[model samples]
Target: MSRTVPYQPVLLRLLHSAIALLVFGSLITGFMVYDRYDKRFGTLNLPIIRDTQGIHGTIALAFLCLLPLFAIYCFHIGDRRLIQKESFKQLQEVGKPIWWISLQRFANSLLLVSATFAVITGRMMQEEWLPTGEFNHVWYIGHLIGWLLMFVSVAIHLLMSAKVGGLPLLLSIYNWKIRPEDMPKFWLRGFKLKPSTTFLFFFEAVVIGGIAIAFILPLIFTSPQ
Candidate 1:
């Protein structure tokens, strides 16, 4: 007997892939920044990129721009993939399929939370701080912790997803098949903002506004070198 492949929405694939790539970029450049400036833990002999901090900040800005849409979709349309109210209760059945499912959901939710944490902390930092040997800033420390949490969350997410859905589910998000109704043009027609999602939209707007301010503030209040 042949197994069937699972189908994923094209929108979800696009958002997930873009965010995943940005997250990986941020992680790499973040490490380079750390290796260059704050190697209190240990240092890598990685090739020095003079503007690694700028590169990381640019990637983080892109992430901030895209994350809200992804968050809205996840909370509204893809809620099933995240932790539910009963998720903790389901964890009691260890070694069972439900337990794996719940664990996957928990990891998925953690991924979102940690990503948001990293982005917020990253935005709070000054690009000049790391270069100027100011590594002890609270925001920088929070950003480092956020990076570690995101790394662990992503690992658990992949492992739990593999355990729950095996290869098919792991590959499903990358699948490009799209149903007619799921097309982008049809999205607006089907889109409806419920009372519950209203708050999500408001939150999304606030995050986007904050990102805009994060960009504009540097120009308005330039710190003297």
Candidate 2:
């Protein structure tokens, strides 16, 4: 019999949702804020974001959309797609249905399409791919909306990732060459550990405290005195 692929874990699901919320929020808001190059936000003259604006937008949209469905597909198999046969060979035990594979590919396609639209539109708005637009009334507001959504999404994403195993998971991205002999009998069963009051601090530090600093710093620094 042919072996099948694996599904992502629960914690990862939370992270994906948070990232999606942010990306969609950012994209829609960005549509409002910087729709024109010579737009102004309050008294500050903000440059119309065009060329590279869509790069982050593209990534945000892709991650926002793809990560969840991928996570869902992984959920059925019981591990992250990051550790799949195509990516990480450590997890060859889990199995998946053919239909799930098709869905995953479709999700990936949506992500690519969203990115292309965001990038293309972003360029057009800035006149990189098209001529600059005359001063429109709506663009000034759109840019602010985009920035707000993006800001919220990233904060939530980071919080969810850190709350569970996002930080450690990030570290493990570079992990390599673990000996099969040295490997535990069931790593997926998870490592046993002591729980503590400190767990709440990850909440304080990431969701509340971390967001405050990451977001507020930019606003403070960027605003004209």
Candidate 3:
């Protein structure tokens, strides 16, 4: 039989699946929530809240509920590099600057804080629920800023993930039951593969650039409600 490799953590698989769904849902609703504020983001062609409130609030609330669990998982995995700045000290000897770690921490902090505020504000804005003040006001201001922060944070997270053996670590979550044949290849430091040349390097840039561009375009020249 052929061989295979699993790169993510077993626990991460469960958490990532949960996180992915909730996050995607959260993003959808976020689009709706933001639609209420500034319906334009260049040529990205996004929809406003008026376009869809279907699950925006629900996912926002769910995300609020799910975050604590995720926090626990992050701690359980010994991956506190984001919150625990001291953990990154080991990388400093290789000419890697300390500032990078600080920046990573800041990015992580921004994502959590912004997401937290957005969730709180979102709950407050819900009409069918609590006795929150009208969401039609300046709360949009906070939400807009928070969303922007999240976008920036995710960008940094993806970049940093790659640098820190994030691919195998993330993939490891799937528990793919790595096979024996893949061992030699991995141990070879990819040297046995003809020291290949391929488009793999450009893959991430394309994906990240694509999403960033897509999000920004709708804000620019599109009334795509």
Candidate 4:
């Protein structure tokens, strides 16, 4: 008899992968922009690169599009996994197995907050400001702070995930040997807009609307310069 590894739901894996890629891309582009332009905080001596500010802006735009959808899925289907109401109470088990689960939840919650800050602050940044050496903007300061917070949150997330389930939980996000009856197609039914899903539908609509407004408001209000 072979041991079967526990598998994550395909929908969860898909969402996680998409979010991970976007987050990683944004982080890379953000660093490149920082190194290429801003060094007021710290300096990394590297070869000069041109046009990364534009690349960073492009990735940030994609992040704004995907993040709201990811947040919807997270709050709707994955909130319990990331953070339960009882998580704080698990602090009593600080030296025991339960503590690690709570830690992971807390880390995930922190990561979400950090990512939200990154997205919002990234949007607030005017594209023409950074490469032009205009780091005095409040939004740029907030963006830098968001970047640091995200870096710390991601480190905590990785360490907690490694401690909790070792490599199994980590690999579960990419596992493909799901049971025959557990096909991705079977998962589609859960997405149907029934009474149970009505609230999620409403939540997703609100998120999408908010993102659209955030993107459109500046264009509408900012007069031609």
Clash totals for all candidate models: 0, 15, 24, 0
Clash pairs (backbone) in predicted model 4: none
TM-score of 1: 0.83
- Which of the numbered candidates is closest to the native, going by highest TM-score? 1
- lDDT by residue (1-225, candidate 4, tens digit) is 112355677777877888888778888778878877788778786576677777777877877787776766666656555666577789778778888888988898777777766776677677778667788887789889989998899889989987877877788888866676567676643443332344444544554555666577567646312
Strongest candidate by lDDT = 1
The local distance difference test score of model 4 is 0.72
Candidate 3 vs candidate 4, lDDT winner: 4
Candidate 3: count of backbone clashes, pairs at least 3 residues apart or interchain:
24
Each prediction's whole-model lDDT (CA): 0.77, 0.39, 0.50, 0.72
Task: Rank the models by lDDT, top first.
Answer: 1, 4, 3, 2
What TM-score goes with each of the models?
0.83, 0.29, 0.56, 0.82
- Taking the tens digit of each residue's C-alpha lDDT, what string does model 2 give over 92-194? 3235443344333333333423333333223223323213444452332333443554455445444433433445643442344354533445333442232
Off by over 4 Å in 1: 1-3, 188-225
Q: How many angstroms is residue 67 displaced in model 3 relative to the true structure, after the best TM-score fit?
A: 1.0
**Model 3: which ten-residue window has the lowest total lDDT?**
188-197
